[model samples]
Target: MEIPAPRRTRIQQEKRELILEAALEVFSTNGFRGSTIDQIAEAAGMSKPNLLYYFRRKEDIHETLMQRLLDTWLAPLRELDDIGDPLTELRSYIRRKLE
Candidate 1:
């Protein structure tokens, strides 16, 4: 059987946030295949080994960023005002999404 992962402390959470922010900036500029663990580590102001301590590989960072992007990007669609005229609401939703 697999053991559950330990809960992260506040410092761990903050470091993860730092890593994510750096990953986002690097990934946005370089795209996935073009970016490297060293690049992300440098951007985060941490060593590559430290980054790997938090996440095992580059793919882990990409996957986390994509999941976060999807959750945040789709939040606008979820909040469509159902009480309004459907067409108007949809147009607003589209506009918001585009923005």
Candidate 2:
């Protein structure tokens, strides 16, 4: 049987998002190879140890960010349908992507 992930409290979820946003800024500016956990923690305004409570490694943060971006980028494509008018569907897809 598969183990389910632990559920997070509202504050925990908010902290995770904060970390992700900070990581994005760090990674974009420093690149993944140049970025450090200390940098990300500082950007997030949390201690390195506290950041570790949310993510064990820089790779984990990068992977999570990439996965979220990929999911968002593909969502509009997934909504496209042959049954829908092609022009209208294309316009809708463009709008979603822009947003």
Best by TM-score: 2
Error of 1 at 37 (Å): 0.4
Tens digit per residue, CA lDDT, model 2, 1-99:
999999999999999999999999999999999999999999999999999999999999999999999998998999999799999999999999998
lDDT of each: 0.93, 0.96
TM-score of 1: 0.75
User: How many clashing residue pairs appear in each of the predictions shown?
Assistant: 0, 0
Who wins the lDDT comparison?
A: 2
Minimal lDDT window, size 10, model 2: 73-82
The C-alpha local distance difference test score for the whole of candidate 1 amounts to 0.93
Total clashes in model 1, counting residue pairs 3 or more apart in sequence or in different chains: 0
lDDT per residue (tens digit) for residues 11-76 in model 1: 999999999999999999999999999999999999999999999999998999889889988998
Q: For each candidate, what TM-score against the reference?
A: 0.75, 0.87
